[model samples]
Target: MWKNEAEPSLLEILRKITELKLFPLPEYLSIITKRSNEEFEEDDSEDERDNLIDAWDEALKSSFKQLEKYADYISDNSSFGTHQGVKGLEFLRVMVILDDEEARGFLFSYEKLFGAKVLT
Candidate 1:
């Protein structure tokens, strides 16, 4: 989908998330631990700014497995991946093909990188 359609779709997902009233990361993980009857270490730190904490705060608030499935869907369906969209993803190997002439967006340009175009 184009930017016009994608933005509204994402906003709708966020709205649904708010309506779900899902438990916070720690609380949800604790519940899972109890359900699985598995011993787990408790994090004593209360730092909210931690990266892992922030990731769980955004993506995994409702379910641990949802993000993987969502990422797979995006990988299979989307034509291009943005930096924000691919956050927290890991891959063993990646190959990028760049042709600045055909680039549709102005987010990045190889001309600047190669000293052919100077910044204003």
Candidate 2:
């Protein structure tokens, strides 16, 4: 879904999650946590109010799984940054160039090609 876009929004990612049914929303009425006060009392009933905290946890797990499952597709040798934009995906891969000279040559080549500006 993020193949061509510049940078997809969080809502767009969430929509993709639903479309893919990657992790899926919970099957219960999400709790609405609140600070109890003299005038305010906690009430539990049938309502799906996550207030983001719950939603955040769910989103992270889902997002991480998506990154991990699709790491190969999301990363490349030349450009670590995926144009498809896997938001919140960090440490996508670990690589050993295995040759200091090769690594230096690569940097010099990329600097000449891309003018020292790291591709984002």
Model 2 stretches astray by more than 4 angstroms: 27-120
Q: Which ten residues in a row have the lowest lDDT in candidate 1?
A: 32-41
Over 1-120, each residue of candidate 2 has an lDDT whose tens digit, in order, gives: 467653443335555666676775553312211222231133333467555544543443333334443454334433433223224446655443233344534433322222223444
lDDT of 1 by residue, 24-78 (tens): 3345433333332132123434645456544533443333233433455347653
lDDT (Cα, 0-100) at 38 in candidate 1: 31
Model 1 gets an lDDT of 0.43
lDDT of 1 at 85: 33
**Residue 58 of model 2, lDDT score:** 41
Candidate 2 least-lDDT 10 residues: 31-40
